[model samples]
Target: MASAFQAKGLQYWVSELAQAVLPILPGSAVEIRRLLEHPDTSLNQIGDLVAQDPVLRLHVLRACNNQFAEKAAGTLSNPHHCVSMLGMDNISALVDSLKPDCGANNRFEPRYLQAIIQSSHAAELALSWLPFRHQGNADQLVLACLLYGVPDWAMWRVASNEARMIDALVQQQRVPVEEAELAVLGCQRAELAKALAQHWHFSDQVCGAIHGAPIPSPAFLMRYARLAQKHSNDAASVRMPNKTEAGLLAHSQGFTVHLSNTLAQQSARSWYSKPTLRCQAIVAAYLDQPLVRILELTKSVALETSRRFAIVGVQSPAEGLLWPQPSAQRRRIKPSQMDAAVTKMASMLGQGSVPAKAPKSATPAPPSQRPDPLNQPRAIGIKSEKLPDGLDHHAIRSAPKPAAKPAAVFPGFVSAEKYADYETLINKLLHQPSAFSSEQEALRSITDCLYRCTELERVVVAVLNPERSKLEAYYAQGCSEAPALQRFTVQLQPPNLFTQLLRQPAATWISRERQQQIEGVIPGQFRQASQCEDFFLMSVFNQQGAYGLFYADRGLTDRIGLSEAEYKIFKSTGAHCSKYLMALQP
Candidate 1:
């Protein structure tokens, strides 16, 4: 009887701790759960629902990856892939797993509920306007917007005291949330959220969006726009915008002003019916603002929004979007000290412990003492002083060179005849100037054709930025469902893989052996961002310097080899594109 009582007590304690740390799914997510319960629901339909809620999306992705990591051969990056991999049955099971008690009956503070509602509103705004501007998947925009303020929700759940303090600082001290978080906790909320997201194995694009990095993708831009609009405030400290103000601001930002205003009013009406002070404040503020003042606010708001979320700029620590490591101050606790452990965990969540500094050594090492053999120069083209007894030195010195090895062929490529037919189709498209209306259309069509003809898992077309310093992907196929491809970018600095490839006129296949040699030049974060293991890069150019490049890969597949014929065909496609580009020049 005593032992059973102790076990029951321990279970209760654990349940409390879980409630403190685990996030509650918002209303939209609960609705999605209901939809998932139905037998007729499709994976795409569930994916669409999951994409609109960040907390649900994160949970779904984590569950799917954890359950099917071996079968998928890799961690799934997008919700669509997760749904497709897990199927409707597994997805329903996942929803069941997350169906905890979350509603008005739960003891949640009004402020916490308000923040979630605001986040949902931001998602709704993105869903309404972002699809009109961007290509690729609309679901991406929804996910990005929903997750833009996830750090706040995370903090609210795990460390309510710190969350309250940050709110106090923002409201009373009139400081920005980021600044207040840094001043009080010595770490930014976004950084903490990014660390948690990484722990949950979120894609680099999601992490980057949370970190407010310049991703240049449409979803990233829409996320920034929604966040900027959500966080925009007036001199009077109003958190929500007036309907007229929202409409004008939306118009300035190239959205449909009337639709935006209608949505704003609808959200406002819903909030007004709620019994929250924050909701009342929004309605009151909207009533007080004049049209002239609202119009005046639009100019500064637009300028500030642009500056806060610029598409192109130098990368900073905030923009670096790296996964943070745990602080050295965090220590393991014994199981016996359950109460103390729980308290410590809560404190750690609320106030991130500062990392301890390393003690300095007695003295620094001299340059000569730190010699590296890999950096040392080696003698080349020098004849040896002695030869083996059986060796003929004259024959060895004057031996004819062996023939060059042929390029490797990719596995599962079509036969030579079929490949010829594919090439014929591509060449015909390239030669026909009237087939495409413009240079971009022609380039995009070629990439699409290559993706279809080659039957590769992924293909992308990246062009040099106007500065000729960075390569940014503008067109991609096969992997449009993946977020990484949509936001792929590479710098062309020296000693980098991209620079090495750009210097050569021919296409180069990145085998595993070669990938290791250039690992130093290619950062691990870049690899994570692209989420591709093996690929071939072919530069496209014509007389004027190299303008763009084609990247193809069988991403996340077991097939890892590229054949000589495949390489030739890949290079031939680029050559055809080059010829078409040359013909377009005046």
Candidate 2:
């Protein structure tokens, strides 16, 4: 009788924690809980969720063992064991913990739930920005950011017109979420997220991370959330109009150039780039609309996109080419989360009617349509995005800006139709552009092609100067489009402080103080922001004699220094640019 009472009392308390914790956390009950209780959930991945408990293993077993209690035919000899012992249904239930609905029972116009959903999605999208930097801790960073807006639910019940603030900020203020978040919420989402994250007894690091997110750290997944909402797909050149603004966000968050471009391009289409899908999906579901219908809504699309991109890889952390993981499976952005967010939106229109864009080959506007973006919320075709030039030149030379991006015409899907043109252009530049008279000419031609094809945001080419044994920037793009920047060059000096590292017969990084010390020793190496932050490297070569390095704007993309995966890309880009430069040499 005493043992039975203990079991009952334990069950009751566990239920209390589940009820209190589930509604407060982000992600579906199935998603967050799996990550929370999953033993296989790495020490690194989902640190925000699992790191909370002093005894996570105990909790994992507890959750799993107790899961089947309600339906168990008989008591197992040793019930308190691993999740594998529980049936899949019970295990999944523990993972898919449902809140006992914090039922206010109030029907809010425009639906308060939708705003809550969108805000959560926006935070998730911010978290989706991890992969590009390839930072080891990227996944944890993402969860921290995704959970940032959950605390604002406290404010949601007070805002009478829930949708009004989000809508007005986007349409009238031209806020692309982060800015609007600043405008409306008065603080970055990271702060709000950290506050709630702390309230829930998440890892102080997670709380620290939410606090640390807008600042810098190599713990990238959370850091990149700062850049989740704003992404532009073009990388061959070195300059972007908003690169400066992006860099500012990065520095404040603590990212270096290494991550900027890598994350930026990766984020362009991947859901990992944003977390909005979950928020929007949840909002849409609560509003009672089909998944497809709500993603088509635009009133909060920018925020939605941000949310989608930020959570790009919350599932699988540390995925590389060597690993086969969910993040690497290459799937379309899932609207699984849209189910709930859509319900919130649907509730606003009593009839459940949503604004959808007209299909192609049909008139976009109806005769009696109000001049509202809301009325035209159907997914707009991503245009051929024209990139304008002539504003900035990179470190090496002055050149015309990459041609302006044509208006973007997005294909409906990521099938061959969407990537074909980019692939075709790359093939042309890769194979046929070798006929230039000199490497310099070859470099120019390649830049022009990359720009016209909208393949690169910036380009840099360097050759080792025999006398200095250093890489010298020969040609560069997307930088100081000013005539002066075109003529500039910085010596990729060998590390004086990193002498031991350089002597190791392999590539390596020295200490930061040493790197800074050695940099001061270079004659022309006075520091100035390159790609919007101090980005100077002491080239350390491995036995392979690899030379030259490239980085994107610190705030604009990911952490700098090329990875093995990108080295292959650089080889191709470098080979083509070298040929271009050789042809132009007098």
Candidate 3:
């Protein structure tokens, strides 16, 4: 089959592609097969396991979405829901039909495996970044990025030699990637991806992400332009988007997915690469945040990926920061490609013209005077303050960065203490100001009060960073059972529950009934990451306003619903903690 398909170009590959052209990780396949054999295997278990392997994840989503669409039902993007819809028999059959290469006895090709790992990293990065921009359809975005390299993966499975040649020409010979793909594969990788997407009947959004939207003919473009202009001129005239126009518009998300993929791949190579910096610059401009802040975020997401996924042979991006890889050479893009990228980015963001190029004869502006899009004004409700005539309070607060003190050791569980007199504990913590040495210690004591006085099993105090854009977990108690709470971080933009609370000093409790009522307002990510419902959140404010919040839950057990009395005490404790925080501000 390999010999028959050699250099057959895009159409042939699309038409003749084998059913199992994509390769799942050998280890994942074995584990999945083992689990499927078990009589009590749950859909959630399979979904969680399938999530680790991009190949299997795509298979499940594609199969479920296709099945649902055939019945005129909306498609399913959530993996667990997909698994449930397919049923156990269908999933078992699907797993059984995987290629011989998926057998655990077979070894993975290094380059092919690298591509899979990179795609996984990209998906994780995209999912982690949803709160910042597009919070809706988070799962769909992850699936899109994971499947971005489907064409390449399929080629690696069926045509390893051609794949090797393309990589060689691009990496070893330093040829432009598009030129290299054309020379070796008889078509660009993106074009092949687009063809395969169509052949498999992928959704237009995914199809757009695979190779961008299909290029419209000049006649089609002119007709659309005329319709748009006529509608703009006449309020009564309706500008309807036909099938072609809707398909074209659906692919705008492709650029965001592409940026995620670029960052994932380059960060794995080296954090300091020119391509990496360029990607970060683009993101910084989009988010209206400093380039340095974006760089820090890049590192943080890479660390999160490493913590989340445990793929073999692939080193964590954070590892490169410590023992720098000698082989991790920075790859520079050709000027032609770089210019095209900038122009495309400008047009995609609705900026019609490219940034004007500075003339060589012109004196270069100083870094301070130069136009930096990242340094633009903050979004509404996020204020920008000019530096005052005194010492910078922001700098003073951040200067004494210390290692996070470990979670305080508390006595063993006490009986019948649930919702007991918390007034004494709250008053003691409030009155004894000198009892705690640092701001974090004070917060930790108050967090422990919930565990000691209330039936709540988990408590976390997340403080705002200096920029006040995110709340990072500063202290926690009763979170040993749920480690996700320990690393809890919440972005304070894009108007989520956390952002709304930060608008002013406020306290809110989400009981089971309340969670159902406001489910739409609560971000899917916060639900997934916090891994709780029926929780308590009380905002703590300093003089500057909206410092942080206290989060508590009954743990995953949810055996006991949080009571109004406990909520009241939690609010009072948070209030005193806010006073302590403000007192230490100077």
- Candidates' TM-scores? 0.33, 0.25, 0.47
Tens digits of lDDT, candidate 2, 101-181: 333453431233433334434333333433222333443443444344343343444432323444433322233544444
Estimate, for each residue in 365-447, the C-alpha lDDT of model 3 and write its tens digit.
78888888977765432143644457566675557667898855323223335334455555545553433433544566677
Q: What lDDT would each prediction earn against the true structure?
A: 0.53, 0.36, 0.65
Model 3 CA deviation exceeding 4 Å by range = 1-7, 16-18, 99-108, 214-251, 315-319, 322-586
RMSD of 1: 28.8
Model 1, span 230-284: residue lDDT tens: 4346443232231232233211221222222223323322222221222223322
Residue 218 of candidate 1: its Cα lDDT? 31
Regions more than 4 Å wrong, model 1: 1-41, 52-54, 65-80, 103-109, 125-137, 212-586
Off by over 4 Å in 2: 1-131, 152-170, 173-188, 213-586
Candidate closer to the true structure by lDDT (higher is better), 2 or 3: 3
Full-model lDDT, candidate 3: 0.65
Question: Which 10 consecutive positions of candidate 1 have the poorest summed lDDT?
Answer: 320-329
Candidate ranking (TM-score, best to worst): 3, 1, 2
